[model samples]
Target: MSKKQEQVLCIDRKTLPASWVTQRTVLSMDFPTFAATCTKAKCSFVRRGIAEEDRQKKQIIPYILLQTADGGMTAAYNRQGNEKRLHDLWSIGIGGHINPEDSAIGTDSFESILKKGMQRELDEELARRVAGDPIEFIGIISEDITPVGSVHMGAVFLIRTQDPEGYLPGDELRSFTWHATQKLSQLNLELWSELSLELINSLNPTL
Candidate 1:
């Protein structure tokens, strides 16, 4: 096995709640299948409406969310020209679309796909921030369907690190910080999606 696959194997799924384990099976069936159906229908509809050239350029994006041991979340902002808009950040998880390469892995199982997707996005986004350091995988904590109108399936992973100090926001992020779990309600930031919040609450219920 590759080093990355070996590290992923070290994650202990037994550490998660029994209820979460059962729920994961149900979610794996519901969301990914629903997402696949939606993608097919959307592509069919778009192909009928647009020109051939435009259709070829379209892309579908996958979704991902990241949780830190501390409760702080990552978000991006649009700045006005040259003003250096600080604090315009929003709260969100790290994830993107599943590329064609991801589809060739021969995994039809949603759980397998979700796990692979998490590793891909984390490595792509956090690599530079860590300066090539390693990230340890924990286990999946929760999963959810995005709003009906949205075109992405969301999965929340419960990740922990002995050293939670190396993370730095990339250019897309205005700023990122680890906030106390209790203080999440006080901030004006967007509320984390239900699954994301559930994972956080599972880890630190008092918050």
Candidate 2:
């Protein structure tokens, strides 16, 4: 099948918790409560094209923010050379759409599925291993105002990785640099990164 015809994991917006506003980038939420409700909510694997246009369904993306123990973060896939709308903008997270391969849909709970997808994305993009114990859930991000954020939902996570050699990004993650978390505000960050910077600084350990 073509890329657009490929199926992706998605859940109905109504199935989300009351805290999930339709058009806001929410930085705080009860992760347990949200996870419990979502685990039981019915999800459908819809075609990518259709899912992108359906405001009723949310394509779940595990947006991972990688931070080192020394107080730095591995930034995004550089879009400077691309002809896309995000051109010249830097991304602060890595991860992608959850697929049927990551989750068995109705058979597996949302929490389990999300975990698998997060690991799969990390493994696929990085040359090193990302520890699972200290993963921090930042919050949910949504923006119905933008075309890309309109039909999608982001579950932001801050992962503590101890790569002594620093970040060497490739593939989907592309190229990245370990920037001091305190200096992130100086760079041109993507929308999600910009919106969540405050919370990240407050929650994640900084140098």
Candidate 3:
């Protein structure tokens, strides 16, 4: 199959049956805990460190969430052996570990970190489908904190492009779609840190 076609057929690893899509009991958590667990595991690319400015220790991961003009968002879903999972089950933002090169040279500013994270994720996921340069940054939506037990802070960013119609999901993402901002409430998203949701919601009113 062509690269474009392959991406279109991609299904998130955690595909759930249609019956569970609107199931109230199943939709209790909005933000998936898998990422947080991955962060805590400290495996491979993931790492724990302290901020250079204030020396505040934090678990940092390079993450990106796509924000369209209509306030729609995109996320990757992790399929844990469920065939009936809905499209939303595999929905998660793009992101990974921030490598040494990402912070190399003079690119240590928050903006720099954001730019590097977004670029790396897009390149890795859409490399087969997109031929041009990387996607541009719209703005920083908010910085989120994980729950008390977790030692990580989530940085939510708002990003977009003139043409968002052609995103090809690689192994990391099963599929991609534009989810309405208002619908975010339907998902059972638990912020890792305190007030993370409030911060993100405040920054993006539609969320």
lDDT of 1 at 92: 48
Q: Which digits, one per residue and each the tens of the lDDT, describe model 3 over residues 20-127? A: 222111111222333343233332222222221221233344345555544455443443322232223443445544554565674365445445755776678654
Off by over 4 Å in 1: 1-89, 105-109, 129-149, 191-195
Q: Which is the better candidate, 2 or 3, if ranked by TM-score?
A: 2
TM agreement with the true structure for every prediction? 0.48, 0.84, 0.49
Instruction: Sort every candidate by TM-score, greatest first.
Output: 2, 3, 1
TM-score, candidate number 3: 0.49
Model 2 Cα lDDT, one tens digit per residue, 1-207: 776888988888888764564666666655686577666776778999799788888888888887776556555556553226667777887778888887655587778888898889878777765454377777778777777777878888876667635445665554567777777777787776776665575564444
lDDT of each: 0.39, 0.72, 0.39
Leading candidate by lDDT: 2
Clashes of each: 1, 0, 29
Give the lowest summed-lDDT range of ten residues in model 3. 4-13
Task: Evaluate model 2: give its TM-score.
Answer: 0.84
Model 2, residue 150: C-alpha shift (Å): 1.0
